[model samples]
Target: MQDRFLADVLANRHNRAILERWDDLALPDAWLVAGCLFQTVWNLQSGRPPEADIKDYDLFYFDAGDLSEAGERAVQARVDALLGDLGVCIEASNQARVHLWYESYFGHPYAPLHSSRHGIERFLVPSTCVGVRPGEVCAPYGLALLYDGVLGMNPLVPHRDLFERKAASYRARWPWLRMAADAATPHPAA
Candidate 1:
């Protein structure tokens, strides 16, 4: 099932374009992650347009060698220049520096991460926890939840309030989506 979804995502012109540009940039441990990857699949599952209601394209990379805010901004500027024509917001964040400002920004204590994938693992929802690199999709939380159309929580760092709020937003857009019982609890298979 994941393979099928991966093929579909790879076939998408928007995704392919983004992936190509991301590859061209060649950022260290870079990935086209989050909504832009999984939401396309959700739209497919619900028979909606592939790019419908996607908020942004998240590009994450780990550059521990230069964990300064200016360093991340420089990379972000480069990304903006590369993907500015896409007509969608492209958010680039350095995983190495997330812990420095995460608490101030989100009111939570985010532990220092080792790599880009470590940051992916802390996503609020299981379905949104997927990332795409040059040739593969990485889902540390497993793809079964996404394959079964179940919205599960990351037991490692469950943020129930944010999950419910985001679920409401998603439900409003994709009415077919079902919410889990609680933030810390994984939903039953669909």
Candidate 2:
């Protein structure tokens, strides 16, 4: 994999601390994998002359089990406190996932963490579920690492479908989350 432009931007104190320390967390292995992929892609995209830029770090948690309100709140509070201590701004959506945005005047988490189902296979191991962004016109530095020792080219934008057979065998998860989410609310009789 190549080192992305975002790496340079996040190389600062706060982000560097968070990125380096994420592995130490006892959260599921999938969390670590997803976080790794997100960070890698963000770093790459941030450096390029972009059609878009990452404004905040988004962490999407894909869990098959339904969490209770108390459980969710506890998790969010813990994550928020950890981020606060790191001097980073953290927020969570109604879904109970954490979103870490850069607090520095010029820092941002521009890259988004999008996830989908791994199907019937045993993806419960946190290290399995990973996110992938599309390739730019010209390959970014260290992009090869994203492939993780594989010889292939992925066309999925913002995220690629690597193991389709596995994804297909099981139920479809997170089908259109990004598509349904928008900045605007419903129009009034327009």
Error of 2 at 137 (Å): 19
lDDT of 1: 0.79
Candidate 1 lDDT, 90-132, residue by residue in tens: 8899999999998898777889999898888888877678888
lDDT of each: 0.79, 0.33
Off by over 4 Å in 2: 9-12, 29-55, 92-190
Off by over 4 Å in 1: 181-190
TM-score of 1: 0.89
lDDT of 2 by residue, 79-181 (tens): 6766667644443322222223211321322222333222101122111234322221112223333233222222221122433432332213212112212
- Model 2 RMSD vs true structure: 15.8
Please state every model's RMSD to the true fold in angstroms. 3.2, 15.8
